[model samples]
Structure formats: structure tokens, C-alpha cells
Target: MNKQETHHHKGIEIFGKKTELYFAVLCGLFLVIGFLIATFTALPFWFSLSCYLISYFFGGYFISIEAFQKIIKGGFDIDFLMIAAAAGAAYIGSWAEGALLLFLFSLGHALEHYAMNRAKKSIKALGELSPKIALLKKDGKLTEIPITNLKINDIIAVKPNTKIAADGVIIKGSSSLNQAPITGESMPVDKTYIEDIDNLPAFNDIDKKHIVYTGTINGDSSLDVLVLKLSKDSTVSRLIKMVSEIETQKSPTQRITKKFEKYYVPIVIVSVFLLCFTYLIIDENFEQSIYRAITVLVAASPCALAISTPSAVLSGIARAAQKGVLIKGGKALESLGEITTIAFDKTGTLTEGKPKLTNVIPLHNFDEKELVQLILEIESLSNHPLAKAIVKDIKSQYKILVTNKASNVNAIQGKGIEATYQQEKVFIGNIKLMESAEILVDEVTISKMKALLEKGHTVMLIGLKNKIIGLISVMDLPRKMAADTLKRLKEIGIKRMIMLTGDHQNVGDAIAKQIGLTEAKGNLLPEDKVNAIKVLLKRDGKIAMVGDGVNDAPAMALSTVSIAMGAAGSDVALEAADVALMSDKIENLPFVIGLSRASKTIIKQNIFISLAVVFLLVPATIFGLTNIGLAVAFHEGSTIVVVLNALRLLRFKTK
Candidate 1:
């Protein structure tokens, strides 16, 4: 459909639902008017009866239609039980009681719909974040076009203070962007074309330099952005789709409740029949017996039980989304709550993925400046994390000295780089790489490397023509919040936390100790990480693996629950992970765990309250303790109670 037609259809649908709610409210007002008239005024009997009948038709007509529809489909539902009870009340000549029951039932239905829609509002708001039209740059002139017409590589101009229309990389201009909508980050992130285009590791909002996503607001400077994704495939669009799918997935408790409902309705109907038969044998009054039977049906309709889990799950999902944690579904949410052990990858998960140039030690009388110059010439061609750190550091310090380029630079997997610079063979890597090159490291250099490794620095040997020349140390620093996050997880009942990495054991242990983790295992390949996760699962039963989502995909897939850290940019990670943290904040991990535990607790509480209400009210209604109107009140009241209780999750805070 065209946009206009699609919007028209949506408007009609929204109008229809609102009209239904309004009609329900109107029916309630008429029922109250009829009650007050009958009780207070000396109205004629036929006139009062006419008012009550009008109220009943207005209030009960839709419910009766729905009940009959279910019956025709060979099914039973709450609507069927409610309509039957209302009909029984009217049959017993209790006009006011019947009218009140239908009014309360219709009102409750409207309110329940309102509450559910409220819970889904955050997801719906995602659709509204992106603008409908974008400013396309054509022939050096800005032209407004629908975002749907924008394609990959199209250059779009974003004016200051305007919402970006699509996900794109900045090719020109510099600005700060507020990405709060996508990442829930509070501060405005600075963006520039020069630095970001060169260092664009991945398209994440947290990385916040080159990429501007749909729905983010640009600050104070015009930017020309090259579109990287179509409008529908943008971050906001995918998030909306994810949340919509999540809403359709039922939690374990909800699934069981659904099964319970199918049988519960039939059993309630049979029990009502038996209750009526017994009352008839005892009282010998058919009307009074039927009245008691209808009350029993109303009191045991299972409305509260039907609503219990979904209300809490929906609320929890919405709350988590607001906090920048995207839980795929209720199943994942439940599994996260039961996590006993969490395995963390070293780089990009616990530590900042970026490494820094820390120490440089020279050997064989090589000048430090010339060594840095040769290292930069060799490392400039490689894209390894350490290479980038070295290149960045050299460019900042010895930019003038970097006059020559390396020839035939080849990176050895898991080792380092080899190249020829200035008619001399050069190799820069770990001691293993030096050993592979048949370069001998003396005792003094080996001791220095050990000390650097012990201090959590990754040391690389600089070898020139089969002789050890110097050593460079780079450290991937822990994230500022990593220590506090680990401590908080411990506070909240996580007993086992381990750091798994491919780095050396000394380096891993040092990083782990800094981050408050006692168990650290290093020198693990990707497959070895998977094996470690398996071992953890065997010992802890329920383990969660958290990583940057690329190299750790296998291990994450093997764990009980998989979390992707800083996944807002990586499509593979987002798809592979059960839960994704949009920003690079490790502190959110504890919040997610805390939220999952709270949601599970709320789900159990809702179920208990619902079942408890049924257990208490059904017996009261079957005996002479409660009447039909009182039974309906308590039944509907319990449903509202459960819904309101679940809604409390919307206000959940990690603190």
C-alpha cells in the first residue's frame, strides 16, 4: 500500500479501538444511571425495567457477540462464561445485578486493553523516531525526498538540530550527535569526518564517531552523510521489529497458563452444572440454584490467571529496552534470571577494545626514534588492534620520521607482522613470532617482557634481520565500570565469574584482578573458549557467555544465555546474542541481571495472586457466602490487581 493509504488504515484501526473503549464507558454510565433511578426515584416499574434492559443491551451486546463467536468455533473463553452468568442473573429477575455485572466486565476489558497498549507504547515510539523525509544531495543541491527512496551510498545533508533520516557514515563536516533514542546514552557524542572515517571499526552508536543512525539528533553543525543502510534496515527499524516479535512470544508460565485455561473453562462449566444439581436437591428452588451456579462460573473464570504472566513480561521487556538492554524474548529473559556463572571475553567485553602504546624497550643499541619509525612503517599496513595502537601513537609522536613504507608486510595469525623496511628485513610480534623467525631473545629482554606481561601489558618483540632489536608493550585497559559491575553482580548473587581470553595467563590474570574477577583463564583459541564454556556449564549448570559477538559467537552459542556487549553496531552479534547491550557500558550487565530476577519474581507473584484469588473466591461463591454481583466484582478485581501489579515493572530502576 501507498503511505497515505497505509496511514489511513492505521488511523481507522486506532479510531475503532478508541470508539470501543468510549462505548464501554458510555454503557457503564447508563448502567449507573439506571441503578440510581431504580433505587432512589419512584419510577414506574416498566420505565425502570426499560432503562435496565437498555443498559444490558449496550453493555453486554459486544461481549455476547464475542462469546457466541467462540462457541461457534468450538471453543470456550472468559467472554463465554461472563455472558452466561449475566444471562443467568437476568433469567432470575435480578435486572440491576445483571446490569452491574456486564458494566463492570466491559469496563474491565477496556481498562485491560488500555494497560496493554500502554506497555507497548515504548516499542511503538521507535517507529516515530525517524523522520519520514530526508534531505538528499543531488547536483550539489539539497532536495527533500521520502526516506524510503534513499538508498545505500546516497549522500544526505543533515542540518543542525534535525533528526537524521537514515543510518549513514559521515563523509564531510563535523558535529556532535545525541544518540539517546537508540543507545539510551545521556550525553551528546562528538562526530567528525576525518578521524572517524579512518578508524570506523564497526557501525555502532556507542563508537559514536563516523556513523549517524536514524533517529539521532545532530548538534550545531551541518553534515553530509553517506547512507550505509536503507531506511527499513536502520537500527530503529530493526529494534521495532525485534520488540514486536518479542511481544508475540509467550513466557513459559504463560504457555502453561494457556493450556490450563483450555481445560479450566470446561472443568468450571461441569462443576457449575454439578453445583446447580446439588443446590436443586437441597433447596428445591430452581431459580436460587441456578443463581448460585452462575456465581460459581463467574468466580472461577480464570481471567486473572490468563493475564498474569504476559502483563509482567511485557512490562519487564519495555523497562529493559528503556535501559538499553534488548532481550530477544520472554524465554531469554527467564533464562537470564537463572544464570549462575558468567564467562567474559577479555577484549571489547570487559576491557576497552582499544589498546594504548605503553612501553618501548630497545636492544642491540637500536635508536628508540628509528625503532618507532620502522615499527610505524611496518604496522601501518596491518589492521590488528595492537597495530592500530602503534600506528596511532607513532603518527602522533614521530610523524615526520615516518618517511618510508614497508614492503610485503604479512600478518601471521595469532603471532604478529613481518615486513621489509629500508632494504632491511623487519619483524614485530610476540616472543613466539621471534622464536618462529629463529631470533634468540637474551635473558635481560625476556625478564623485561615477563615484567610487562605481569603488569597486564601485551609485549611484542621488534626483530630486525633475525636479531632481537626492541620490545613494544600495549595494554588494553579495563573499562571504567568493569570493576564496579563485577562487584555488583556478586552483590546480586552471581557466584562464579571467569575471564576467558587468548592473551597470556599473566596478562589475563592482571586484567582480571584489576576488574575484581578472581578466576582468569588465558591462551584460549576460539574453539578452546567454547570448550571452556562447556566445562563451566558442566560445573555451574547455567552459564552466560558475554563477548564482542564476532570471535565469541561459538562460545556464546554454546552457553545457557549469551549476551553481546556493545552490539548496537554489529549485526552478527545482535543476531547471535540472546540479549544485547547497546552501549559499551559494562555496568548495564548487572542491571540486566537484576531486572531479569525481578521480572521472574513478579511473574511468580502474579501467578500466586491470581490462583490464590481463584481458590478463595470459588468456594465462597459456591456456598452461601458470596452472591453473583460480589463474585463478578472479586473476579474482575483480581484481574485488575494482577495487571496493576505487573505495571510496577515499568518503574524499575537498577539502584
Candidate 2:
């Protein structure tokens, strides 16, 4: 089948399995038929009884069988209590009332199941993003093949508007790509071979412009990509895998409910026995006492309590995922609500991570245009972040064609470039590189470089023939939303916000001031970042560390919570982070925190509602204030109310 057809079939398969709703409707139909036959029609007693029996079995059969199995295993649960209550009603000659209890109980189960499945639709929709087939390039020809057959290093062709079938790097062509499926970014990212290939500093570095991922739509231009990862290991595939595993990692509240179940069932059974004995001694009537005991069992079943946490957590997760925030599990969601402090990595977290040319200072009577042209020519040959920024700026502002560009260009590690431009030897690097070359930089120029550095600009010294000519300053500007996001976080009770960076202390402090951060620790090595996170952990409340996810992995792992920003394109970031922000926008941070706090509130409310119902109803049943029918109505009513309350999270708006 074609990809569209396959997706259609999968959707149909999921909707076809909604058996609980159908079964509940069927049971309700039989109960109505039985009541009408007994009350209105002149039907025989056997016929009416058979209709009631059908309704009872249709609604109560699975419940009774589950209860029986638990009893066989020397266990009792809410199901067993429900079965006992229904059986007691039947014993008291209230067959219609027994059928009603079973019907309502089954209806509650079906509604809860339907609501939870509805919340899971967002995760299930992820499966539809990946295409089933790929356009494989073999021996310079394109052939259609299943995506599953594609392997690492395989070349693939993605046409305009078609979905990319694997994670790969661009070998040829350029296009604007819609990466919303993978990254949740609302904007279409521009990609081109010229910029990526020319400015790439290292082969292993992630060229955001050149890399395309599975499930993302290619723009109006075609692209030839070298597959770096197979279909199974692609970003979208791992996202689906992670979302599928969320249910297995239960929240603390869920674990407590499970433990509470172990003793709760037995306690209810004992309470039933004690109530029956005490009532019989007081009333001296066996039938009335037994009925009251059954009412107490139904009233204290803990159905709403059992569903309270999972329902709220599941809804919260679904809502967050819809907004491009992938919370791994309920534990992470709950932990987010408790985070008191947040730490951010400078580059890629608070800043855009894309440096731009801010200033170009020429020295020694050097022509500014000539120096810019020479720097551009040299930088165009390299792919470092700073080089890319300089080349981009020079190209946009000046028309410099390096037709016969520099030759024997060598990239000096941790410094800059060495090349022979126009037959004159030239060097471009930092002060360290200048010192190594024995170039004389006047104290005036040195002060200028220091002044630029203090303003958070990275300075690159340009030298020609062993003489310092000029210097270019580049800086990665802070993201526009960084300050606003920090303000929102503080408004919501975050105690401290700190920035950690590998840049110099002056640069870090300057950027921190721009972004409203109170403290910043700069010149931090990877290990130093980890030590900072450890020390922060020893202080007051939970700390969350946010970063690009690659270099910050160690420190993030040490923090209470790890968040990865712009994780759609980086597999390393996704793997290292506990929570992945699919897009680059920092504003989503406050939304996630708010959703978590709201979920916690709903969980507490649901638990209180459930427990209060039991506490109030159990005493009423004991004191002859409630009967079997009223107890069943109130008990099932609470379950429905709690489920509906949890469902409110599905409509939660982050904005």
C-alpha cells in the first residue's frame, strides 16, 4: 500500500477496537428492555428474568471473573467488593437493583477508558508522521524502497514538499524545511549547501542547515542527503519510542495507590464483616444488617481514589506533548512542579548560539574594505561558527569575490586560520595565535580587544605578513524570549536563575545582565559545570539545568532535572535530557512548569474528593442513613466526577 493508505488503515484499526463503549451501550439497552418488559408488558416471568439476566451478565461477567481470579490468588480488590455488593442485592430479591449497579459500574469503566484513550491520541498521531517509503539513490539513479530497507550511509533524494524518510546530511541542493513534526518549531528552517559546507568548522559538527530528519517536510527545492542514521534510529522514531514507554514509569502518587490497594481491599472486607456483626447486634435483624453491610462495601470501594493520579498525569502529559514539550514520564512532570532553581547554559540555551559580526576594527592605516574582503575570503574557506558569522556579514554588506582566493589555507586548532592571500602570507587568530606568530599588537589595539571582550564579543585578530592589521568582533546574541521567559519563571515562584558557560567571566556576566540573570559562572570546563550543578543541588530545593544537551549532558545528569532545548535535530541532546523542548523557543519553559503545577493541583483535588466521599458515605451507611441503592449511586457518581475532572487537563492552554 501507499504511505497515505497505510496511515489511513492504521487509524481505522485503532478506532475499530473501541469495544468498551459498544459493550456499555449494549448492557444499557438490555437493562431498559428488561425494565420495560417487567413493568409495562404482560410478559411471562421467565422472559423478564432472562432479559435481566442478560443485562447482568453482559455488564458484570468480566468484573466477576476478574474478582474470582483475584480471590483464587488470595487477593481482593475493588472489583471483588463490587461483585459482593451486586450479589448481596440479588440475594435480597432486588434483581433489578443489582443489574442497575452492574450497569453503572461498567459504564464508569468504559467512560474512563475512552477518556484516557482520547488523551493518548497526540502520542499515537506521532506514528503517522514517518513516511513508509524512501527514494533511494543507487548507482546515480533513484529507486523507491521501503524506509525500513534504508541503512546508514545510504544516499537518498527528498523532493520538494515530500517527507524526509531518514536522518541524513545534505550532500547536494538546498531548501527551506518544515521541521514541525520533529522539532515542534512553527517556523520553516532554511537549509543550503553553500552556507553549511563553506562554514562547517568540523565534519562531525551538526550543521543545522545541512541536516534533515525523518518525518520533516522538504521545502520547494530538492535535496540529496547522505543518510547518517537508519529509519529505526532516527529522531522521530526515538521520540515515538520514548512516548510509548511513559506509561511504564508510574508517578510517586501512582506507586502509593498500588501500595494502598494491597492493604485497602482486605481492610474493606474486614470492615464489612465488623459492620454486619455490629448491626445485627443492634437491630436484631439479619436481612437489614446484611444489606447495610453491603452498602458499606460499595461506599468504600476506592474506585475514584484508584484512578486519581494516573488520569491527571496522563492528561498533563498529553497536553504538554501537544505543545512540543515531551515530558518523559509522570515523575519528571511532578518533579518539574517542585523545581525551585533553574540553571541555563549560555550558548544555545539563553543565547541563539549563532554568532554574528558586530564590529570590524582596522589598524595601522589599513583599508577597512580591503581588510573585510581578506577576512571574508579566509573565513569563507572555513566552517567555524565565527567564520560562518563573518562570511555571512561580509557577503550581505559587501560584494567581495575571492575568485583566486587564498591557497594552502590551514586551520590552526583553537586559534584561527593561516593562508597565503594574493601571494602575501596572512594569519587570522586570537591573541594567543598572534603571540605565537611574534606579531606586535600595540597597547592601543590590545585595549580595544579587551574592551570588546568585556562587552561579550569574541575578537579575532587579523594579521598580514607578520603584522597585525585589524580585528573582527563577533557575538552570539541572547534569544529575544530569554528575558521574558526568566521573568515569567520568577513570577511563578522560581527562587534562583543562574547561567553557566565556557566563555570568559566578563562575557558571561555581560550576557547574563542582558537576560536578567542574577549570577553567572564563566570559564567553566565540562567538569567544572558538573561541580557547579552538584553544589547547587546541595542547597535548598530541586534544581533544573537547561542546555543544548550535547556538552551539558554531564552537568544535566547531575542536576535534579535536565532539559534539552532545540532538541529536534540533535540526537545526543534528546538522549541526555529528561525533558526535551522540541523547538528553540524559551517561552515553553514557563508553560511546562505551569502545566506541571496545575496537574499537581488537580491530583490533590481528585484524591481529596475521592477520600472525602468514602469517609462521609461509610459513616452514613453504618448509621442507617443510606441504603444499597443510594450508596451505589454516590459511589459510581464520584468515579465519574473524578474522571471528568482529570479530563479537564486535555483542554489546558499554555498561552
Candidate 3:
């Protein structure tokens, strides 16, 4: 059958819906009439024969067509086995049984379609959320056009609450935009017009003045943006492409399973054929031999087992995605269930990784406010993360409006910032910077800094006119949910949780203790992280690694299951990970682990049930204790049972 001809638009195809209803009605009527008549009527086998003819034409015709197609393609699929079994049942004077098989088979096909349609709803939702049109500007006049038709360098206008159609910059207006869908960020961002265009990257920074990407929502204020890229060039496009690549690259187990089936199928076929031939030779009856052959074929078909694992895994993946967790595939799902140890990247994974003022120590009479204000003055001249922390703290502390361009300002790489503030040379940096500037950081101040550092704070020294005036410590602090998540994991049989970081040991240790973890390793480069994971695995524990930054990609690749913290993690990190947490809630960790374990269990149960029925029922039918009708019924029944077993994955939850 041509797929296109049968394909129907989801919401608008009236004919397709009516046809489906018609088929369903016919199936229900035929089954009810046949079963009731066979049980209640005193009519001969002729009555059963009439009911079978009506039912077979209604459902069996489709199966026969599909089976013939498979034969022509040189593929001996379950479809062929099913039709043959149904046809053989009719030949041996078992009319009602063959009709029953057709009815059940049709029901299974409908259920399969329902599952597929449900799964595709996610992609459809994503598609519908994207904006369809954009306002394009040309020759100083703007015209509204479909977003797909807009090209590079075209300027567009975006209203509040409207989705951004393409990746571009802000040229004419400034607003706080919500980029949650694109970046997994929870909050809106304030984007302003670029003042220094020359400082920006020259390559593909289309319209350095204004840019917006597809799927990003504009803020309350309406703004004009330039279209730098179409859908295919946007960030989401790149992510989609990466995901496609990941899907196409099959797991090691999947490749091995395919090879196993390649050899397994032929051997099963040969064995079944020989068994049938031998039975026929001994019995010397053509009909008996053919019945045995049909029984053997039905038993040999691995539909139940074949569909079991993939269905459960696929359902689990869909469930995870709906709950803001993105797991790649079955291989990843399997690995997650077996993880005994989890290695976490420190900075963003554990800590908030954003500056919060922790402690301030004054040498003389200066208070926290004065020291922070002076530090902010020097920090405002630089764009380093530590510098931003000081500036942020000053605003929070005193509402000071520090100058953007500091006078007599000097920033030393890997050191601190020095600037003239209120006619005095104020310095803010690490201990080495103060020492290099000949500013004496007294032993008492050093001890105070060490005390704060030991408590998971980064210490920055502040000086006035070359004299050390105060000690300032800022800490990123652990996420509020981390402790609860860690405790829950321990209770759930995860023995150890380890922290890996590129930061100093002091910071890592403080966080580990606060979060109730005893194991902490710091100062690890990206490569060192991978080596550490290998070492952790050598201890005979299945490992899971969680990270968010670009640097964490290598470690993610090395773990048994890598879960990326999607809320703040880089695209590279997300792509490298097998599982991803859509939100920043670490509490979801236990939930994902539980879901994986449940899915695996269901898959195992399905395989066992399928194999048990095949091994037990097929032989009974072969020995003349059961007929072809019983064999077909068992075969189709086993397939339905396995499918329903796999559907249990959809109910898995992690709260």
C-alpha cells in the first residue's frame, strides 16, 4: 500500500476518520456474532463457516496483502507467519478460531498506531510553538511575510509575547526576552543594542545591532530585530541535527543484537523446517505435516520478544521527555538503571556558580559597604566573572552607581584590578596581586581569608593607597535542592556521590561537606575528569556523571550514564550527555534512576513471557493435542500481552 495515499491530516481528514470507524465497527460486529453463534446456536459447522467468511474478508484481506508484499521483498516477517497461520486454521475446519485471530490482530495494529501518534505529539507541540511569520524590512520599508521566506540581513519587528522567528540582534529596541526554550534558562534576559559593534565577532554576527532566534519569546516591550538566519541556521536547528546524528549512531548493544538476530533467525527457521519434515515423514500424511509446519512457523516468529525491548525503551524515553528529562535512547536508559556511583562536576553542577557576598573582614574602621563600594569601582572596569561579582555585590549593598570606565584603571590577567578611587590607589585581587604590589596582607588577614576559603568562599583582598584595608570573600553557594537530592540518592542504594572540579580544593571540600558528601576531588582538567571517571569505574561501581559547562563534555562521554544539567549547561554538554535534566532541580535525579529501573524490569518481564508461551504452546500444537487455531490464537495473544506489558512504562513517575 502507498503510504501517501493512506496518510491523513491529523485534524482535518474526515474520510480517513470515517474509514477507521467503519473498519472498527465491522471487526466488533463480526467477532461478537461469531463467538455468540458458536456458543449458542445448534447449527452445524456451516453456521461457524458463514461467520468466519464474513470476519475473514473484513480483516484478513489486509493481512494477506501485507504478507504478500513482504514475500515479494524477500523478507519473511511476522506478517507472513500471521497470514499463513490464519489461512491454515481455516483449512483445518477451525473457522471461528481464524476469525478470532484476525480480530485480535486488527486491534493490535490500531493500538500500535495510537502509541505512535501519542509519541509524535511532542514534536508536533514543538512545531506549533514556533512563530510562522516575520516582518521583513527592505529599502527602508517593512513588510510582513512568512518567517520561512525571510532571508539574511532582513530586519523584522517582534511584539511582546510573540516568538522570535530567526536569530538576529537588537538594532532599534531593547527588551527583556524569555529564552527558556532555546537556552533552558528559567528567567528573562535584558538585551540592549550593541554600542561597540567593532568589538563583536566579525563572522556571522549578522546585524550586530539586533538579532533574535526561532522559538525565543520576546519580552513585554515590542522591539525590532534583524533576521540573521532562517530556521535551518538557528541554534535549535543545530541541536536537532546533533540529536539526529546521535540517533543514527546505534549503540554497541543494538549492533550486536542485530547481528544476533541475523544468525538467530536462519537457525530457527532451519530447525523448525526440519522438525516439520521429520514429523511428516513419520506420519506420512500431507495435511498433518502442513499443520505441523504452520505451528513451527508461528512458534519461530519472535514478534513478542522483538517488539518488547524497543517498545518499553521508546515509551520510557517519551515519558522522560515529557517530565523535562531528555534521555537519548534504550542504551542510555539501560545504563542509567545500573549506575552505582555518580561523579558530579563542581562549579555549575553543585554550586550555583554565581557570586554572593559571604564575609567581609576590615583591617581598620571600614565597614562592608565601604570596602565593597571601593572594590566595585575597580571591578566595573573589567568583565571577569569575579569582577562582575564585586559589582553585583556593591549594587546590592549600597546601591552605588559605579563608573563604567574607571580612571587610572589597570587590570592584570590572573591577578586583580587596580584603579584610582576617590584620589587613592585601591587594589582588589588575589593574595599574589597584593604581594606583587608591595601591599602587606597581614598574617591575621591571611588567616581570616583562609577561614572563609575553608568554608567554600573565594577571597579577594582590597587595598587603599597601597595599604591592605579589608578582606572580602564571595561564594557561589550550593543549590538549595542539592542536599535533599544527595540524601535521597544515598537512601535509594547509591553508595557514593563524588565531586569533580577545576576549582581549588578548598572550594570543593566545603561544598562536599555541606551537601553531606565525603568524597571530593578538585583541580581536575577536562582530561583529568575522564581519568577520574575511569578510576571510579575500576572500583566496581557503575558511574553516572552530571555536568553543565562546555568543559564537562569530555567527562560526560566517559561515564556509564551522563546526565547534563540542561538549564545552564552548554549545547556541547547537552549533546554529549545520554540523559538531560530540563530544569535545574537536582531532586529529579532519583526520579530518572527509578524510571530507568522500572523500564528495564518491564522489558525483561515481556521477553520472559513471550519466550515462555512460544516454547510451551508450540510443541503441544505440534503433537496434535492442539490445532492450528490454538497456535494462531496463542501467537497473537503473546504479541498483545508483550505490547501491553511494555505500555506500563508510560505510567512511571518520579516526584
Better of 2 and 3 by lDDT: 2
lDDT by residue for model 3 (497-540), tens: 99987666777899899998759997664557768888988895
Q: 62-142 in candidate 1: lDDT tens per residue?
A: 667666765887977666666766676677666776666677566545444442342145355556767999999989999
lDDT of 2: 0.73
What's the TM for model 2? 0.65
TM, every model? 0.60, 0.65, 0.64
TM-score of 1: 0.60
Off by over 4 Å in 3: 1-252, 255-263, 275-280, 397-400, 403-406
Error of 3 at 424 (Å): 1.6
lDDT of 2 at 242: 48
Model 3: ten consecutive residues of lowest lDDT: 1-10
TM-score preference between candidates 1 and 3, better one:
3
Model 1 steric clash pairs: none
Candidate 2 colliding pairs, count: 3
Query: What is the TM-score (0 to 1) of candidate 3?
Result: 0.64
The lDDT for every candidate, in the order shown, is: 0.73, 0.73, 0.68
